[model samples]
Structures are given as C-alpha cells and as structure tokens.
Target: MTGDQTRKLALVRNEVDLSEGDFDPTLLAVRVEEAARRLSIGRTTMYALIRDGAVQTVPIGRSRRVPVQALSDYLAQRMQSRPINAVA
Candidate 1:
C-alpha cells in the first residue's frame, strides 16, 4: 500500500480500537475506507456500492461518511434478497 493508504488504514484501525470500549453514541458515521473494512470489502467495491445506492452516505463538510445504520440496513436487505441454502 502507498503511504497515504497506510495512513488511512491506521486511522481506521484507531477508530475500531476506540469502538471496542464504551459505546460512543455520537459516532454515527465512519470514513468510507473504515466502512469498507467493516463490511470486509475492498474500498473500490464500497465506493461502487455507494454509487449504486446500496449503501447510504452523508456529507459532512467536504467528506462523505457512511452511517452505521446504513451498513446494517444494507446487510438486512441482502439477507432478505438472498436467503441461505440449507444442505439436504
């Protein structure tokens, strides 16, 4: 990864570490890269999802952030659309 990418990843890691402690109700959103990490997806894929409206984002200043509820809603929608198959 490039230096910029490394720095972004470190920032995401720090946010995650903070989340492990007491829940911060004020943290309603996260950086796109951090959201991608939470979804176990590539940054590019996350952006695509955002573009396709599969994930919702809010504009904060000049940056766009994905709301925590948006991630949950996306997962819920996916689960409804694609049911798990059971072995016979």
Candidate 2:
C-alpha cells in the first residue's frame, strides 16, 4: 500500500479502536466512508459494491450505514469464492 493509504488505514483503525480482532464488537455500524477505509477501497467502489449487492447497508435517518457484520460477511463470501490456491 502507498504511504497515504497506510496513513488512512491507521486513522480508520484508530477511529474504530479495534480490540483483539479485525472488528470491534461495540461498533455495530459505520459510515460509508469509514466502511470504505476499513475495506481499503475507494468510496466509489464501495458504493458500487452496495449497488451490486455485494455489500449491505442500513438506512439511518438521512444517511446510510454499513453494518460491521455485513463487512465481515462480504469478506468471508469473497474468500470462499476465490480460494488462496485458486489460479487467476
């Protein structure tokens, strides 16, 4: 990752205050931008994922929030579909 991306990831990690694992149980949901940062994806790509149903979100007032579990699920599904030993 580039320096800027690393810095951003650090910022996101600090903001989320992750404990012993990849996610913090206390944080049930996060803003779209935060979710994007957590996934190391651009905002547009994140939105595209949502649009494509690869990622899920919840409506909150006038804003949309991505559930922390949704992120985990997305990652798990992706890993399942593309195994580490699979050829490109």
Candidate 3:
C-alpha cells in the first residue's frame, strides 16, 4: 500500500474504540475501505463520513468495521429523495 493508503488504514484503525470481551454478532461488519468501495466512494470520503457521523461504524479489536445494516440504512435514507417507482 502507498503511504497515504497505509495512513488512512491506520487512522481508521485508531478511531475505533471499544471495551469488554465480546461483540454483537447480529450486526454486520466490513473494512472501512471495502465499505467505501462498495458505495463507489473513496477512502477519504469514508473517513469524512465516519468523522461527521453520516454513517455508523463499530470497533472490533484494533480494526474498524462498518456495520452492513448501518450502510444499508444510510443508503436508504439517501434513496428517500428518489421516486419509489422510478424505472432505471
């Protein structure tokens, strides 16, 4: 990875904070970059969203994870502006 990519990954790795011994498996988890990539967005945008609370993320150990449901909900919220039955 390039220095920027490594830094982005490390920054993401550090922002996640959690405690205790277990996690809620009912939630879905994905790497920060992967999540942004899925949305056709970039890493910086992902970090910005997390910082701005536009989306929710969960911390698992030293790695940060974006819950699938959270991403889905975010997209749903955005999709509200579109017509429900609009054909593509």
Candidate 4:
C-alpha cells in the first residue's frame, strides 16, 4: 500500500478501536475494510456483500465507502429476516 493507503488503514484501525458500538453517522462514510471490521466480518465477505448489493456503498473518486446508515440498515434487514425461537 502507498503511504496514503497505509495512513488510511491505520486511521480505520484506530476508528475501529475507539468506537466499539457504532460509527458516527455524521461522518460521510468509512473505508470498506473498516466497515467490515464494524460488521465483525472479513474483508472478503464485505466485498462480496458489496458485490451482491446487500450493502450500499458510495463511490468517491476511485474509492468506495460504506455509509454508517447502510451498515445499520443491513444489520436491521438481517435481524428482521431472522427467525426467533420460542421455548416451551
């Protein structure tokens, strides 16, 4: 990775460490890898979700970012579709 990329990755890592609950929605978006971290998934899975249109992303120049709302929306959709079990 170039210096800029390295710096961005470091920033992502720091963001991941600082905000354990959720990202700040006031900010536009986070890097794909950072979004993956927030979702507790791997980068490959995040990319696949993006490719499959399961997660929404914004394109800024050559970089793609996942909005904080998109992550929350994706999790909400998953939770809504999940089946709940009841014990007798």
- Give candidate 1's root-mean-square deviation (CA, Å): 8.4
- lDDT per residue for candidate 2 within 1-88, as digits (tens), equals 9986676566545564433345534668887877887888899999999999999999988888999999999999988999699885
Worst 10 residues of 4 by lDDT: 15-24
Task: Give lDDT for model 2.
Answer: 0.81
Off by over 4 Å in 4: 1-25, 86-88
* Per-prediction TM-score: 0.69, 0.68, 0.59, 0.68
Given candidate 3, what's the lDDT at residue 46?
A: 90
RMSD of each: 8.4, 9.0, 11.4, 6.8
Ordered list by lDDT, greatest first: 2, 4, 1, 3
| Residue pairs with clashing backbones, model 4 | none
lDDT of 3 by residue, 1-88 (tens): 8986665555444443322322233435777776786677888999999899989998888877998788888899878978989775
Query: Relative to the unseen true structure, what is the C-alpha lDDT of residue 66 in candidate 2, on a scale of 0 to 100?
Result: 93
Q: Candidate 2: which stretches are off by over 4 Å?
A: 1-25, 86-88
Model 2 root-mean-square deviation: 9.0
Q: Tell me the lDDT of model 3 at 44.
A: 100
Worst 10 residues of 2 by lDDT: 16-25
